[model samples]
Target chain A: MIVDEVDKQIILATQAGLPLVAQPYQAIAAQLDLTAEEVMQRMRIMQENGIIRRVGAVPNHYKLGYRYNGMTVWDVVDEQIDYLGQLIGQLDFVSHCYHRPRHLPEWPYNLFAMVHSKTKTGVTEKVNIISQELGEFNRQQEVLYSTRILKKTGLRIGR
Target chain B: MLSDFYMQLLNDYQQDFPLTPRPYLAIAESLGVSEDDVLLAMQELTDQTLINRIGTIIKPNKMGKSMLVAMAVPEAQLQRVAGIVSSFSEVNHNYERENRFNLWFVLMSSTGELLQDTLDEIEQQCGYSTMRLPLVADYFINLGFELDLERDQELDREPDNGCDRLSTN
Candidate 1:
């Protein structure tokens, strides 16, 4: 991410998360001495460039009543897991989906997805839906439930 | 019930919030409120910690390499062990799960070699074996959830100050 001076100003200003005032851009513009239009344009360019992922609030699912956090791992055919992961990820019930390297014997699951709901049963329902999605391709599966959140700190930039 | 604006902001704009110069103005227009009013409400919601921030959520492994690591520590040493792991600059998140494999954390780095080296260092320091699950593939990874009003009060937690300075790894 090669950010120029103006982009740096924009990032340093907004990376902590966007300010929440009425004239939010103007507020950032004042600090950078760039026009509000200019600041927005720079951020838009950054987004297009992948410097910014998406502009919005990242809801704390736990805080949103997703009481059960299940890490669903699946043993799918290697060649198919990549394609299967994409299909499963598009399911509304799936919050997070990934392809992770598996540790053989002890951990033979290569596909991973995170499912969350308000209760354990709610989580099971979602898992069942996923299992059905995987069907014959899923050789085996395990749902690892998070017991305690030992640490939940998100990286804060420019700290 | 969620305030009309709250529903609109949290539910309607999950996937795409405006990227316009006056983004809030655009939001305000849709919500039938003045731009300044929308700004005030958003700030208050943020201050209230209902939302993390009105900014970007970078997808992991998008820019740099990262891995999910697990360490099996005896119950007695979990805390001290976790502290050591969390202190490392590269450790993004440290978690405790239900299995015998209790301690898990994430590490993101500029290179894959750096990621391996960090995991090795933790294994040596903590005296416990580690499991590394690197991002071999990404299925569906993104975040957005419309608040279920029925569980609003039940879902509330101590809203931590989120804007405090933290480093971007």
Candidate 2:
């Protein structure tokens, strides 16, 4: 997925959002001086390559009343991580699940799943369900709740 | 309150939004509604700030390198340190969490060298050591969140859990 200058331009132009119009691609094409077909073709290719994960509305979890967001981290059996992680990731409430290196004594958890809900109790319930799913493999777990959003400008590539 | 039509629009079109000349029209046809109706609902959603944007979600580290960095700033200096960290274009999604490592942020750059440079710069500016956690593997498929709109309505009736006050900060 080698994105050229034109592709970069397209990403820059639409990363914030597609134009709210009848012909959004045409609007993007006009801005980049490329044809609508070119924009569509490039975007389709990018989607195929997994460069563009999806093309749609990004809902604001907080605004949608999903006020409680918990980063639930777990220390699972090393050999069973991939299998356990896949199971956790498939849960509808788990938005972003990943395996990251632990920082020794301070951070013993390697598996992280971000759970969201309308209430704190709801968040805990979701965590409980995940714990049941992990079962014997789940060694230890902790949830970190974000207290404040300092910055949230998503993926900006400078021109 | 979100109408049934709005819920359908949000849930089904989180991924695989049309790439045609008239995407809204395509959506309307599939949903069995007029194009104008779909456009109006989308506009309403945007106006309410429910949806951040209708656009492409770029895969992480596909175009460049990125890492999740955390810092334990003293409470008094958290705001100042966060301001300095957020000033960098490379730093996105800075947050204050309920932990010893209070400040967490994601930093991204076009190259590996650049990413390291930005991290070093943040530590130097903030006068705090950072714990860098890079992704080892991603387990989740990148499909967008599926909104259970009806469940949200039901939950709205439940009593508060005393955590809603934290949002004021």
Task: Name the candidate that leads on DockQ.
Answer: 2
Q: Is the docking of candidate 2 incorrect, acceptable, medium or high quality?
A: medium
Per-residue lDDT for A18-129 in model 2, tens only? Answer: 9889999999999999999999999999989888888888776666678888988999988999998899988888888889988889888989898889788999999999
Error of 2 at A109 (Å): 1.4
The CAPRI classification for model 1 reads as acceptable
Off by over 4 Å in 1: A1-13, A29-38, A49-51, A156-159, B141-143, B151-169
- Residue B164 deviation, candidate 1, in Å? 20
Which window of 10 residues has the lowest lDDT sum in candidate 2 chain B?
B160-169
Give model 2 RMSD, 1 decimal.
Answer: 4.0
Query: lDDT tens string, model 2, B89-137?
Result: 8886788889988888887788878888888888899899899899988
In order, how many clashes per candidate? 1, 0
Question: In order, what fnat does every candidate score?
Answer: 0.57, 0.72
lDDT of each: 0.71, 0.82
For model 1, what share of native contacts is present?
A: 0.57
Off by over 4 Å in 2: B151-169
